[model samples]
Target: MSLGRYVGRRLAITVPVLVGVTALTFSFVHLLPGDAVDAIVGFRDVSAETEAAIRAEYHLDQPVWDQYLLWLRDAITLEFGESPVTGRDVSATIGRRLPATLALGGAAWLLALAIGIPAGIVTAVSAGKPADEVGRLAALAGIATPNFWLGLILLFVFSVRLGWFRVLPPDAPLVSLATVKFLVLPTITLGTAAAALVMRLLRSSMRRELDAPYVTAARARGLPERTVILKHVLRNAFLPVVTVAGLQLAFLVDGAVVVEGIFSWPGMGRLLVRSILRRDYPVIQAIVLVIGIAIVLANLLVDIIYAILDPRIRY
Candidate 1:
């Protein structure tokens, strides 16, 4: 199929999936024990009338289906309503926090690519050698390590003992040097697993490509080893890596809650954790919807990239 038609088809499939996600998120969030009003008021006791008024105001007295319909309607127009906990607009809150998450995720993604691709290439080229063995071992360790534990270790060594970085992220603008300094440890902590995953996948891909008949054909044509690998093999090997990277990018965007909390980063992940704790329904629903959108779009982008990288791929 044509590129435009392919994208349209994917988007068509995505809309219903996102709607289902929203419905499920709304239902599941409401199903959690404890009322949002009680969470909002904390330990303080309020009058019965006041509690009723609060519930009426937020339509908490409505049926689950009613609330979901109301939310879905508002969401269509990009209106996410106010946070029950903070009384702030959900969209505004997300807007403020999203940049931080993007910065963190983007830096981590770049770091992963910088490390993973080259390491994968090296490991593949030197397969069965000590370097390959060491790379595999390190990748295994990276995959096994927990992000929160790694963040704490990095924070303790770099920020506590060495004083090279700060425990808490800075209040500086996202583009500033101070922000970049603060992001280093978090980036490394977040990116390590993704890098390891990419490395292993790419190494396997390249090894398979190396054994393909085309690699021998190129070599027989008097092409340099570097040319044969880079020009012919790596392109084919990179297709799976592209898919993994795209999915990882989506995961990084929404799944950095633990890392963000550990480092006190003011990102969407941190906001999500807070919203969940406080029973901020609107915020939680909005965040989940955003995550769903990200995942769908990331997959779409990956499909497009696949078609671009390997012309043999078709919709």
Candidate 2:
């Protein structure tokens, strides 16, 4: 397919995926045993009229499919309804928290790329040497390190023992110089695993590309090592790297929940945890739908990047 046609096809595919996401989110939420209304009303004894009113208010009296349609309709317009726990609008709640998550995710992604790409290139260039072995060992450690544990260790070393950083800020400010400091540990926590994965992928891709006929021809023509690797090898090798980066960027949002919780950063992930704990169906559904849409869109974006990087790529 042509580039435009390929993009169009990808966008077309996204619609059903989003629909399926919404359907599944709604179904699974209702499937969970427990009354959200009961949680909302709390331990107070209530009359039957009040109970009926609460059900009607949330459209719980409607059929399952009907509730799904209502929720989905509001979600399409970005109106995700009120939170059962906080009585706040779900959309507003998400909007407030999303920027923090995005900022952290963006930082982690850039850090991963900055570290992973260079490490991968060096390992590929120095294959079978001590540098390669050391790189592989570090990557292995990074991949094996649990995010929460890494986060806690860093917290103890940096915040508790060294006094280099604060564990939690007294006042959470989204934009400030201190924000960078606030984000450092959490970013490292999330980025380490992603970086390892990217490094491994890039190293393999680079090694494979290095063995190609064009690379041998470039070397035979007396091209400088840097020129051969940068001008020829990296372009081809970057396709899979870009693919991994895009998918990981999507995952970073969800992954932020753990890091955010460990570090006490206010983000969508924390909100998600709270919503789930409270059985706030509307909030949970909205958060999940947003995440699902983000993943689908990220895949589409990767496809676009693929087409740009290699003109031969098609839908």
Candidate 3:
């Protein structure tokens, strides 16, 4: 199928999935054991009348189906209601916070690409050499390390001991120099594991591609080693890498919860944790919906990239 038709098909599939996700998110969040009023106000501090008023004000007294429909309708029109805990508009809060997450995710993704792709290539080319062994070991270590623990260690060594970075400064504007100083440890924390995964996948993919008949043909045709690998081998090898990177982006967005909390970064992950703790159903639902959509779109983009990279793919 044509690219346009392929994209349309993907998006059509995504809509219902998102709707299902929204419904499930709404239900599960509400299912969490707690009174929303008590979540906002300390238990035993509020009168019955005040508690009833809070429930009525937020329409929490409505049936689950009605609440889901109401939220879905508002969300379709980009009206995500106010946060029950903070009394701020959900849209405005997410709008203010999403950029930080995006910036952090983007930085980590770029770092992973910068470190991973080359490492994979070198490891593949070197095979059983010392460089390969060291790269493989490092990747193993990175994959095994917990992001929160890594964040803390980096914070202590870089931010505390060396005084090279800050330990979660007040929410600075994203994409600025000030934010760069704050992002260093968090980026490393988030990217390290992802990079390791990507590196291993890439190395395996490249090795398989190199053994293919076409690679031998290219080499026999007098192509330089660099040309054979870069112009021919890497292209085919990179298809799986592209898919992994896309999924990694999704993982990074969701996994940012731990790193964001550890660093106290003002992002959707941090907001998500806070909303869950405070039983802010609206915020929780909105964040989950957003994240679900993001993952779907990221996968869609990867499909498109696949089509572009290899002409064999079609709808």
Candidate 2: Cα lDDT at 59? 91
Give lDDT: candidate 2, residue 60: 88
TM-score of 3: 0.87
> Which numbered prediction scores highest in TM-score against the true structure?
2
Worst 10 residues of 3 by lDDT: 167-176
The deviation in Å at residue 188 for candidate 1 is: 1.1
Write down the lDDT of every candidate, Cα atoms only. Answer: 0.87, 0.87, 0.85
Where's the lowest-lDDT run of ten residues in candidate 2? 169-178
lDDT of 3 by residue, 118-155 (tens): 99999999989999999999999999999999999999
Positional deviation of residue 102's Cα in model 1 after best superposition, in angstroms: 1.5
Candidate 3 to native Cα RMSD, angstroms: 2.9
How many angstroms is residue 9 displaced in model 2 relative to the true structure, after the best TM-score fit? 2.2
Name the lDDT value of residue 164 in candidate 3.
87
Could you tell which candidate, 2 or 3, scores higher by TM-score?
2
